[model samples]
Every structure is written in structure tokens, then in C-alpha cells.
Target: MPDGGLDPVIHAPARLRVVATLAALGPGDELSFPKLQKLLDMTAGNLSTHLRKLEDAGYVHVTKTHEGRTPATYLRLTGAGRAAFEAYTTALTTLLRGTAS
Candidate 1:
């Protein structure tokens, strides 16, 4: 009714980028922290903050493990996250097409 309302949580620029990156991964696939940081061109602390927000919202699943004594962080989108992203895209498309519903 409001031109396909946008998701406040995913509307932030940083959060949008994070969600988009995660959405690009194949189903059940994950991206490493360093990879994400490089891809997004974000600082380690900045990326970590955004990840924490997404994780807190249950939109992301994070796994921390050791790879040859090096800590590795992996991030994946949850089913709920995938669904929310889909809806967000749909709403954006609808708004862009000037079809407000």
C-alpha cells in the first residue's frame, strides 16, 4: 500500500551491501570474513560491526573455526534471510517500476 515498503533493517547502505554480498553466495555456501571485507572494501572493524548487526537480526549465520591455527570466520545467509532479501528486492523492483501496491 505504501509503494512496496522498504525494509528498514536492510535499507542502510552498509547493511544492504552486506546482505547483497551474502545473497550472491550459492545456497549453503559461505564467504570468509577477509573475502567479504575485500569485496566490500570495508575496514575489518566496520565489516565486523555490520556482520554483528546482521547476525543479531538472525539474518546471518556465523561460524568461527581454526584453519592451521589461524582463526577463520565464515558467514552464510539463513533461510529467513534469503526470504527477506527476496522480498526486499521484489519491493524495490515494484517501486522502480512505478507500480505501488
Candidate 2:
């Protein structure tokens, strides 16, 4: 067995946190921009930058909508995102356990 490789895209700290947060949500559940920002304790610009990277990787789906008079953004993990996150975790776990696959 060979060691599993880590995914650079999902390995970044900020992006990893974002993906992990989304993975914890229930299926079909999404976190609004404000909520996610507050939860992660990140500034809007920082979160947006990381999210853009994830979105470009097809790991997240971001939707914008108007809530009454205010604009709102929502983010959810796509199937691909979930699978990638799972793989990343598995690889990390294997590495920690000194195991190879």
C-alpha cells in the first residue's frame, strides 16, 4: 500500500475549515454569508476570497439572493465537495496512524 496524497486545494487552513463547516451541515442546509463569517470569525473579504477558491474548484455552491431589502449570500457543499473533504480527512487520518493505502 502507498500513502495517500493530500489535496492542495483542500489543504489550505481557511479552505479546510470552510469545507469542514459545510460538511457538518445537514443535507440541503446552507450557511448564510453573515452567519458563516461570524461562525468562522473571519472578515467578509477574507471569507469571500477563500470561498471563491472553493467555488472555482467546484467544491462549493454559492447563491446570492435578496432577503427583503437586503442582499444575502448562501453557501453549501456540493457532492464533489463532500467527497473531496472525506478523502482529505481519510488521508490525514491515515498519515496520523502511520498507515498507507
State which candidate has the highest TM-score.
Answer: 2
CA lDDT, every prediction? 0.88, 0.91
TM-score of each: 0.92, 0.93
Worst 10-residue lDDT window for candidate 1 reads 1-10
| lDDT (10s digit) by residue, model 2, range 1-101 | 13357788889899999999999997668999899999999999999999999999999999999989999999999999999998899899988898865
* Residue 32 miss distance in model 1 (angstroms): 0.4
- Which stretches in model 2 have alpha-carbon errors above 4 Å? 1-4
Cα lDDT tens digits, model 1, 8-96, are 77777998999999999987899999999999999999988988888888889999999998999999998888888898898999889
